[model samples]
Target: MKTGLPFRRPRPLWFVALLTTFVLVLPAPAQTGQLAPGVRGLATRAPKNMKIDGDLAEFKDAFCTPVEYFSFDAKTLRNRAVQFFYLWDDEAFYAGLRTLDEAPANFADDNHLWEGDAVEWYFDTRQDENFRSQAWPTNANPGAVHCYWTGLKGTNIQGRFCLRPGYLNAIPKIMIEVGARRTRRGMEVEFKLPWANFPDFKPKLNEVIALDAELCYSDGGPRIFRTFAYGSPLSVQQPANLGKIQLVEKLAPSLWKACGPVITPVRCDTAWTQNSRPQITGYMAIPPNHAEQIGVIWRNGHVTGDLRSGVPARRRAVAERPGRARHVSFVRHCL
Candidate 1:
């Protein structure tokens, strides 16, 4: 589903001029709450002058128990760094990200913001073993229902945008905000996600929950971070190899199917008898538009008499129609 309008490339001079004006018009930071005392050392003001090797310390430490720290040092491309922070309250879940860039950043024409520097949040209310399945059970799945916004030079440019939900096989909902200025310190983004959207689970007073967040950038690629409120170790910096995050008290067995949805059962018409040799014959049900193929499975038992018992017959069948069919055998237990 299309969420908003298509991205239009703004003229470079006009884009920069408008962004500068917008930054000047931004309201002063509200005195709602300051950075927690523990993370005061990492708090930094967005750098104004564009210096290549300035103190890259303005990026705040992540508010999420597990968050990624990125360095903005690109030789070929513009050097930029981004930091992600997160916290949860009774009413909503909050995320704050600060980005430092050496050049103006460009957003794509489509809402495909995942192609650029972006932050993604995933919440599993059910806390199922299969995170992807629990978020989206069907084959064509949408990712978690979440919101994303962008901040260019400390100014909020967009708000409460919906993300398209799907995995590798489907189109993902991605939104992009363009015309961010390059400065000594990078851009910063602050976000708030409503708990009403995630009605499946709620947090009690002082209750901590497990959550996962990811950061993607044009320079640094993708990084994943995770947190566990139950005193468990969680890390999201390692995007490709993120360990599983369990939230709920216990996970129930999955009701989803293990194998393919379409199954064709075949019944063999053969009986074992003292004098009659066991023979296999069955009609296979071919799937729509699929070619016919035969497969065979066997069980091993006590071989008191002839070990070569069906060898000759099986060989003869293969020789008669070498290209028509293929047969494979499996032995469960050694006699």
Candidate 2:
């Protein structure tokens, strides 16, 4: 069922101005990860007011997983600006993505999304113990699930595929929520994967799930090349190379504040690069009140710097979970 809600505009003028200034003057937000790629990291619980508007605000405090450092051709750096942020609640896994694509074109209705510019994901539920031993072109592996999103002419489409036995029988009706919007720089997509979709696997705290993310690129043809958060030339056929994600309890609001804007550790584009250019997208209230606390509302780029800061931080408890699939593969496909 759908409900109509008023469209909320950007934060107020004075407030946004203050945020932009802080973002500029403040040092880049500190993020923790091994200096290398494919490192395992933590995924936090979803924020209080999560929305699927294809904007980055709802991803605040979520685990910020970098999709950089992917290798292409085993010799060149697959340097495309893309980041994957995720969270979890009792029922589903949530993902928010921003990709830097200089030229976004390709609105195919077929699996050809992999051939054109798109975002795609691969997953191995690890629900079956023999999943680790499975290999190659012949194995559609009942354990694998693929999902992707692409856009053309203002229209957006998302699709899902599974390798489990009978196509319809093995795949449960996944409750998927997607929102794709073209940004000034490239493109951004947000989605949620309900736990019910993974009938064999139930998410429990502190458990590991095998996962990988790819930013597939094509000017308007078959997939020419791609980048990955994990998985290399043969890794797609070899699931062991995929990284792992550990489900954690929802983080505190204060932790989100500490992370700063969604586009932390700025890149070159000056327009919020997920595909190209990086620039301050917009402003968000810090800590305590978040964006809602801001008093004035301004359009995207009109705010100037007169701001206030008196919001206090609130604390909450960590939820509980104790199970994880032994060798699940998780992949995220996008545009």
In terms of TM-score, which candidate is strongest?
Answer: 2
The C-alpha stretches of model 2 lying farther than 4 A from their native spots are 1-39, 68-79, 136-143, 151-170, 219-222, 250-335
Q: TM-score for model 1?
A: 0.36
Q: Where does candidate 1 stray beyond 4 Å?
A: 1-80, 104-106, 127-135, 138-143, 146-148, 152-156, 165-184, 205-208, 219-335
TM-score of each prediction: 0.36, 0.54
Residue 302, model 2, lDDT: 34
Give lDDT tens digits, candidate 1, residues 116-180: 45554544333334533423333332223432334322222433233533333221332222222
Candidate 2 local lDDT, 73-167, one digit each (tens): 22222225466777787777777776655566665545445556666666656645644333522333254555565544323433332232223
